[model samples]
Target: MTTAKTFSATSVQASNAATPYFSQPIIITSLEQNIWQQLEQEIVRSLQRLHCSRLQDSTLLLLHKIITNLVKTMHRHAFQRAIEDDLNLDISDKDSIFTELLQNELSMHGDRNIRKFCRANNFQITLIFPEEKDTLIQIEYPTSCNNSAYLDNKLAKAIGFILVKQTHDPSSSYSRAKVVKNTAIQSFRPEQAGYSQLLTQTEELDKAQAIFSQLNHGIVVFSSVGDILAISPAILTLLKLETALPSVHTFTNIIPDHFYNDVLWGLALESQEGLFENYRTRIRLPHNNNLSILFNISGYRHSDTTIHTIWQVVSLDHKATDTLAEGSILNEARVHNITRNYIPQLVEEKAREVVRLGGHTLPNEECQLAILFCDIAGFTTYVENNEQEESVIHTLNLILGKITKAVKKHGGIIDKFMGDCVMALFKEPHKSVLAALEIHKHSYDFNSLRMRASRDLLLLRIGIHWGKVIIGNVGAAGRMDWTTIGDVVNTASRLEKNCYPGAILVSEELYAMVTHAHATDISFSQPFYLKLKGKRNEQMARYVQTEDEPFLHDTVAHSARQHLKTD
Candidate 1:
């Protein structure tokens, strides 16, 4: 295209009538892109020509020293008029983006001449108005793709400031044009800009949305302002929500409480600080509150140049879900109050706190509980022999702490720690039996290590019973203890008091219940009836034993670490 100073055209009527078109965002669909593009382009040309005409009078003798800015900026994608900015001289796409983008993007110095480099179009547009010395405007348009001379603005302006790319690949032959006109009142209909050369990028955005909807992956696009602009259909399907989405989308409305922190981190940056990458998180479903999915988070600049965060959810197999008891209140209660991840002592503490906060007493209720009472065999005599107080405390804490961990590991909660003794409760008889086996095995290892260290070897006497107990918080609200108080507790304590060292004794009722257990893992002595303290009739009980340690894995979950003392 010809530079403003050298280029000339025949005088033609330049109308300023704004009848059909004023500067407004046109609401045309992408299918009607041609008309939209023409209107916007004509508006930009008319406005810029008016600016250049103003400069012609203002810079009559000022020459090159009087450079004027391009006053009207428009963004056209293929054949679609996308957006407009009459104040800044930036092009809307990558082809003619401000050359300053190559430098530190934060440093915007505009002392240099206008320049553009289109890598794909294989051309450059340079507008240089040298100092008062040159006093001339020079524009060069070069296409090395073809062996033709680079067209100066004098010839390129006549050709409507457009160049066709000569590429072997048809798809790569996309054409681009930019016109900075200074006509002497000559205005004819301009050549076809990019109507047939390439489709408007709105079509590409439409295709992207279509593909996003069809894919199984969920997509959440957040605007730079953190409001959700669009969401893929898959997000609704994956989150188990209705296919129809709400009008006002936001992270606060969609993301669950557990995962809000992750999205907050993404939005905090807003593509200005840095690129946001995959931040894995759990996403709870809106419609099905019970279900949730693991999502991977990321962010990018959309076609509108707005930052958007995407949450790509990974659908897991049924086996990866929380627990088998889908809607059971009991199971959910256990998760909140008595999860195995905590110490056995802490589980009941948290459970009681939950109940106390509700402003209701834990009413004593009769329920079947697997009560386990265990004590260090000959612990009193061992203490008499070893009178070093600090040594005793250290040894007791080391061993007792390990035993307490085993109780929690087997899904039982510690009811009390009775100096060298432990009383625990379990919902299933099998778990109490497993805990006894674990304690028995641990005792053997403890004695072995003690023997090697020349210390008195210790033994474990454990008793397990399955029967009804009144379980609840005992004492007033200010000071209370969560415990079981019934005949079942006494029977279990008596069983432990009667048991011999290095053995586990179980009541006949516990043995009968465990007989139906899946692979009981415990062998029992022949059933025997014993007349015990306070028992009107004979009490049936068995001496429980395990031949092997049962080669169990260390942790129940994926995250537990192998502790030196507990493992």
Candidate 2:
């Protein structure tokens, strides 16, 4: 290619004969002519290197204008139609075009020329002209490519002009093209751009709804605006209503007498400083005219936007569940409460709550309780020795009175008194442990008196453990007794059998909660694993001291030392 200085500015657009084909004027300086010649050579080399067919359509139109403008500016010729037919043109896919450009030997030569010119003349050249149907030129090369340096200076200048033009009209054709390019790039990205999280959240919500639909009980969802958004079929049935109620029902229609306003609405106003439970409320039933149903209400605030309140309807009747055995010791009040009334009352109340709140409330599990057991050691021997019936009866009654009194002082319930043993219950381990200690103290006090009278004093053994036990009536319909049964009660009875005369044994489970007592020289025995008479499994047992000295294990001396040091 020749240098642009070979042509002057006045020589531009010497293509007047080709007027209709080229309406635009081609303005050029002598230096511009040199650049145009090099550009023309580059374009021709690109087509030859790619082995392309002639261009057509919009692309053909753009190519023609480029070639015509270059020829007019460089050769200063008023070219005819014959001149246009002499030039070569090419068309191809972008991939083939890129491959051809890379394979071109001319581009390698251009690299050498570029470096030399940059070193000697300090002349950096650039190409900034529009493609077909495009108003602004773009930087189509990757920055890290070896060939990109050739166009860097030109691209920088073109971009600067484009940015300045865009400031005036952001929606212009040039800006619109940039926007479209950005949008296409975002759309074609391998990963999701923005909506993936939303889609995942929607799917999770759908799964949760499906799970909720399968539940046996009713469900009601409330929004911040006091609107009842949804009610499940179980909830509708609970209220004795049709399942197909409209979705737009509010809380006012379901709950009676400002129920939502007092409960959730009032709760919402609070900043939620603490959690509370068993807040009670009553709901009016559909069929019952004389009585309103009761519910045990409790709620937790999930977040600022959601408050989940569970309302469990309380059974008006106190019926015993079916686990009760037949022909056992019975309590008439307990039996009447179980068979005649409780279960139906529970169902009705639940139905009322469902109708009022649009869902049934969850029930709370039975609370933690303590088990207390005391047995008279050598009871059979005492009865055997005191062969006289009156003497045996008198000794048994005396021992029972002393043990039962101590149990009552520590808030224990006397479940029953066997020939020589008395079984009781405590609500807390501290109370129960303390009571067991007191029972042993009283046993010693009574035995000492009997020692003064020259009689064999009664020896008592005590056991205690803490756990959950169902405290209700159990047995057949006509006969039932108020009692408790669970691992807690059984474990305590096992520990009682393991104890010796005047011994008080407790379970390790209870010891954890009553560690404070042991710290005060009230050492316990090393945990013993033993099988009970009736049970197949081995259970763990520990002996607690009612006195001020360590009475049990020598193996726990190291632990005792540590406890002493910590004290």
Candidate 3:
């Protein structure tokens, strides 16, 4: 039950006193003073990023005084970074800059920029002290107020100012202070050097960002350390987040604990091999609906040993499609080319079935089949330590070629290639087991050759199970994949994930079929119970492997006979 650790703003509590009054000033330690200074700098940076006009000298002084007073009070429990709703401030002076800013109601030119800034940003300031832990002293430029008469009352509470209203009286003696225009503000017509170029660049950047954000149907970018760089609006919406952005800064906070390991594994593969694509699975959301998503990762490496990963998450239920409208030549050509290019790569059985349907959609059908999954163990580590990219890729392809040939030789259909793993389907459970044994033998020979060559040994872990599954095309209109879907697929994958290197794990159902047939050449370990992920009950499975030279020839001949029967 491992979980992600959450990061929070640093805060310190007074160790000596349980309660201290504002009137009784406490000596501020250097460390506490440093914390306040850092918080002040953070506030300044936030405001600057928002393009707010610089605070006037009087306002700056007031802000410093407030922070200084808060630190001396020894009543501060925590300092929180600003969130969307409010910005807290403490005010004691009636003639302060905030009062002047709020008092401008009748004059058209009075504090208009400041008012726009506050309203646009939804800025509010709050302060909490020892006596009033629940009560907050707030200063905000209100957008609307219900009671005008209560606004005139200057009643002070335990801490300080609560809320100030805009005064419209013409005869009032409160003089409006001079507004400080933002220095960076400029007219549409540029007048300074590089101003036009800068504005053009800024506009282009803004448009690019807007396009990128909209394109993020479920895309996310994060650093190697799991710090989230960006997440798409679609993902935020899918997650049903209350805020416009994610509250947590790390990717692990948003990912389910059960799926974290899979994500980490993908990241490892991508980091070492540069890409991990088309990994499909169904994730149960908090709303209890299972959403089918295809995860793809692309890694960018920098010279300083930093890797940033971009994850493209496509929803299988609502996959993006390009629709052909009347008189749209580009759309028609694009769709035609994509379909022509993709159809040939599909499994032969599925491709022929699709063609036989004569442009009609194939309905999903359930049938019993044996699912097999296999992957190279220690592949990511070997790739990371080995700098020769070409050699790594060549070795990977060689191993996959061997596995693919074994699967085809045992009457199996290659379903898909998931980075280091390959999935296949077979009509017979015994054939699937035979395929797994063949793959183990191929890996053993490959490892022996690599060992003699002084190269890293790559071992394979395989899993097989026989169960009923639905086979059909899944995706949006104009874009779909012929694939198998059911619990059997997941269970087979889990078996592969849980198995040790150079071993083949099979579920009781599949193992029973093999043993009942009395396959004398095959050898299996003792039956074991596995508590697989996403399963309510433990599963019974056994490791199936091949024996030494005495049984090898007979097993290969048996596999050949099965393959010929299927042919």
Candidate 4:
């Protein structure tokens, strides 16, 4: 398994190319960093957007709730970026808002203006937006946080709370642009005078120079208008630029003109939250074949109106060449890139294949979602009694692998794994039911294989429910976990516990959703009302039986099954 490569903060020496890449992980602010001072000054001057939304109080309330929920979820390993309308925001701008709202926790009940709402005994708010330079004065709602990456459930929930109607139609949700791989770039057009002034500022220049020296990867900074500000020595080495860079390091001068559109696409940040693929291209070399580079582009506000677009460049993965052959090797900049399907819960290798064939990451959404929860029956007892530690682990992994396959086969995205349990999400209700049916049917065969091996046969319990769930990045500053969570998730988990061994139990809500779908070949038991754990009221549930297994059309077996379709 490839691990994240770690670079020294202030070193020129490159680590072994075979070693994994590890960028600095960002963390949420705690009390120690004097969090208040930083937060008090971090709110951007774009308070007008919230007030102008026509639902000022509700919007502020909604923003506060999201910021609160996200902060509470942030641990040491998760990172998040905040975006508004497709532009990335400095999600780290939590300090200013936190300082103001920490004590004023408001009651979000009625329709009232923000000023009045802020005056409420316990009202507080926070907002997340993409990084951009605007001269909007410092008039912000009291609550906000810097954010990025997955936590779809939170985002969807937040959006649902504020927008009575969606901004985009369902069909327009998926991106139409050629989704590039291993590359992410954001575009910006800063005012010319401000841009030139920023380039000349001693303080800005010093900050840029200081940051460039410590980075171990190639980075090329430019503007949407094609003006290049600075180029790192690492990138200089990759391009084999002799001597020093000329006075005008424009995009046309540095990047091949043909690839400029790719850079523009990278900057054209999609409004949806997703792990985009990096753009791939080759560069001319003085004495060697063109070397390919993986690029991820993003922009940050250099000043009030100047946007500094940063192009992060890394060499494509290759066999570990031992020696740096002058122009042939890009020493420190060598990196092993992973597919943008960064969510491990999702069967990414296949997802990447889907992406290659025009299927992209599901946009940040609050859509009707079907959530499936599956777990091994009696997993705890089995773990303790199993004598061979390695054997047990291996067997468990094999079982989980099979489950993962079954879920993917029937078009389900594995959300996450918890011990012996797995969570999968689907956009289609019928597909979700089909996936569950296939898994339950496949379980019998799977257990039989284990029995032949003289190992314990696994009994699976699965629960599925349908409801609206948010899908996006939910983590800290540098870490992200792409998954879904909401009442539907909780209901599914509850129903899973009520499941009998070797059976797929489903919630009443789920059963209702799929009942009308004549497309499935399954049987459902009558609603079984039971008092679920930690619940004040009893809920209705049912068991799903696979009367006949449906063939996964997307699978290779679909072609061979043409003859068997009549059965």
Candidate 5:
């Protein structure tokens, strides 16, 4: 019979500032001592790839201490749980029971223990359990663990441990593991030779393919000569291809002639200087001149000769159609007239104004701008109940037309129009408030006319807020828009969404601005403090109305005159 090797339970001093191992000498029965020796032999054999001969005596002692403590602690926990469960486990099943318990505990706390040990020893270590196939419990000392490499290596070293070289800090005198080109453990049975390496290569390929299939952006791997080696599924979806391309395809075969040269230039520049350049271009699909895909291309050098080109779909626009239905109130023709023609002209004028003021960008200087959001209340229900599409379009346009006119008249710019809402920007808070009042008064008159005609009354809710905003071009290339992006816009939209119909809600900031400007004639209801959605604290707001009756009449008359002129 073979006699098990005996390990001394003497405590060892930590190599660094870590706590010393085992404060007290651990006492164990003869049977448990044999079990502990068996566990130690297994762990030592698993880590034999690290070359035990070159390790210092201190490192060997430390490894023994770690193994001894681990076995002892795991044995205690497993027995404790067994006692709690009232399990009468047999002596013959002890090895299997211990193996099961070790797997469970390692899955839960293996990485944590490795982290604590590495910090104490000032080294990096990765452990793998034979039972837990393709799993690694890794801890990186003095650095962040590379999860990707850990995952890949876990599949490679399915049955053994890994030890990384320690940090090259000059102050430390401890001997560290020497760096090796292939850190993967090579200790395995004769029958299992090369099995782990083959499995690792297969797993890596499968993982890469899985990732490419799930990504929203398209990836194209090209050789040094620009031959397409691989392409992701998203490329086919974006280009609207019915079938996958042949394996032997080139970049010029798929890329349009207009953008092929630009892509080539960008790829060459990136490959030469190792700099990533994002090129945005439009691709018109075959037989679809109106539909175009906007792509933002970037490159990643995989090697000295291979480049991975990434294509991200920024925007898909159909020039022949609009966001709304063809016969809706905000139809294709009207939307095109406003967005394509009017908004661009307004943006150009604003750009020119900035240039005249010796500024390179429009509205680059942060200044106070008032945002107003107005929308028709219960508009969705109205659309659902109304069957006459023509009548609905006519009525909806009338209401939106009046709101647009009021905004323009008050020195405001029509930012954008939603289905039943209009967002506007004003240089002055008072002007935005005035526009809100005029919109409310116009809605009142529209409701009066609808009541006489037995049509559903239209009610409007408006919100006004003033804050420092930076206006600039926002959107992907080939389709950019001048817009204001800040918390003020969100707050204004939220206020409009929450306010009662036929009411104009002004934020406390905008109210203060109006009062500071000495616009005392604007009447406001009692301030209401309420919590708005997405806001951390309660906010103060009030419903605003116009106290000047003559001002209201004059604006109404001017609006009627404008309507008559249009007729």
Candidate 6:
């Protein structure tokens, strides 16, 4: 009766070679002080107990190969580097030893002609010991082959397990292992024969944790109920707390009255559709007033039904934005290395800045980047005097979502949103102008759709300009931001404020770039010079004609013009 429990050596061979090897019931301590002795004894006993095949030497060789391979594999970790001081071993020789052990063990298995091929190359085993605190053993072999013996994941894992078990270090215990071929080396604690050195493991983990803690970004771990669980050092600094949120503290207690309804409560319902949803929002902190915060939220399932979450809270100060921009360049670099993607050439320079300064800093550049600013005409009065809260948010979302898609399609980057207004930019002038024109064209259709549905949609006005400016990341460590600065960005904002509802205005600087690309219907509506705030000179601005545009149907145009006149 070939029951599952009554397994033979042949069955063992098939099982051991499978992915995720290591099926024996042997305890780790069994090989603590003596790995080879323990492994040799176990294999002989297992073969005798099975008593199924006459292939005793083959079984014994397989067992030795697996154990030796594991030992060689585990000896090559960075965490184990400190252990070499005791054996006075060189890194290259250490790797060579493992390579030999893996090949030797596999050659003994005889599934391939590796043993005969290795002998033809005049390869021989040699035992060498490094002079130091602990004894080291290695089997040397020549490395000149295209053998299939060195390419098996299952065999590698099995050998790694054996090596780790034999060299037990309470402080340096490895939760993982790897297997090498032919060469094998094992080291143990000087005074304690069974226990390996574990001090390095503990220190590495502490270092990693310290690095995370030193980051200026706020980190918070939340339970299934959205209650704060663990808080990082940065979060504590933001909260002005030496400890976690107080016993009496709740979400509402610390959240601002203005943003609480719109952000916190708003996300809980929307996030069930997907995990790790990010929200760029504003929050009033205890000490920092009117601070912009980016709430990066992600969820993890704790049980079958319960889900826990983590929130990375970061400030949106201008300095922080700059740092973020610099970090983006580095992020782009990491992507480039892994995927061979072509990032903007600026990324390498940004990485160099990080390398020089020990962190990312802003860049200084002069380029003709276009800027667009916009607002919904008459939205404040409508919100303040007539519309419901839910309706206002829903209407704003619909309008913004459409505009956002247009900007993205045209390669425009959104800067910031001021209530109903949006600020967007483009490194390329023609694209920015076209994107703004599209936004103006779509506003009319959106208004019509709302009117037909018996909803009141607000009119939109936009302003755009293009000129040289400084673009880079700026801000403190962890609280950095990505944005532009200079008179050009400010001038664009001023032009936007001068616009009326249903109107699209473009400064001459931007219009010149797109004059060749757009159709003949595009012309000036009102030619006027507008006084701007910061600049000493009066800026000349002209309105683009919204009449008979292809994107604006006759009926919609009439309604928009009527709406514009009535206001």
In model 1, which range of ten residues has the least summed lDDT?
66-75
Candidate 3 ranges with C-alpha deviation above 4 Å: 1-348, 357-359, 548-567
- C-alpha RMSD in Å of predicted model 5 compared with the true structure: 25.2
Question: How big is the positional error of residue 282 in model 6, measured in Å on the Cα after superposition?
Answer: 32
Candidate 2, residue 512: Cα displacement in angstroms equals 0.8
lDDT of 1 by residue, 373-455 (tens): 98887788888989774388888888787788888899988877889998998877988898888887788888888889888
Candidate 6 global CA lDDT score? 0.51
Tens-digit per-residue lDDT, 1-567, candidate 3: 112111223223332466632321111221112123223343343334334425322233333344333322212111111111245555332335534434443133332233233324332222222232222222221122112112111222211223333444456322111112223434333676766654588898998778766756355565555556666556555554543554433224646443334444443445555343333333334443444344444444444434445545544444331121222234456776877633423345544443432323444444578999999877889889775644877778898889989988988888888888898988778888888888888888888887998877787888898886767657887677778888999999998877766677789999887887788767776676777889999888876756643443344334423533453
lDDT agreement with native, every candidate: 0.53, 0.49, 0.53, 0.49, 0.58, 0.51
Each prediction's TM-score versus the true structure: 0.36, 0.34, 0.37, 0.40, 0.37, 0.36
Candidate 1: stretches off by over 4 Å: 1-359, 518-520, 548-567
Instruction: Flag regions of model 5 displaced more than 4 Å.
Output: 1-346, 354-365, 546-567
Task: Give the winner by TM-score.
Answer: 4
lDDT, candidate 4, 287-331, per-residue tens: 344444444445443333233444555544333221222221221
- Return whichever of 1 and 3 wins on TM-score: 3
- Model 3 residue 519 CA deviation in Å: 2.8
> Candidate 2 — which residues are off by over 4 angstroms?
1-365, 516-522, 534-537, 548-550, 554-567
lDDT of 4 at 333: 28
Cα RMSD for candidates in order: 35.1, 36.3, 30.7, 22.2, 25.2, 26.3
Task: Pick the lDDT winner.
Answer: 5
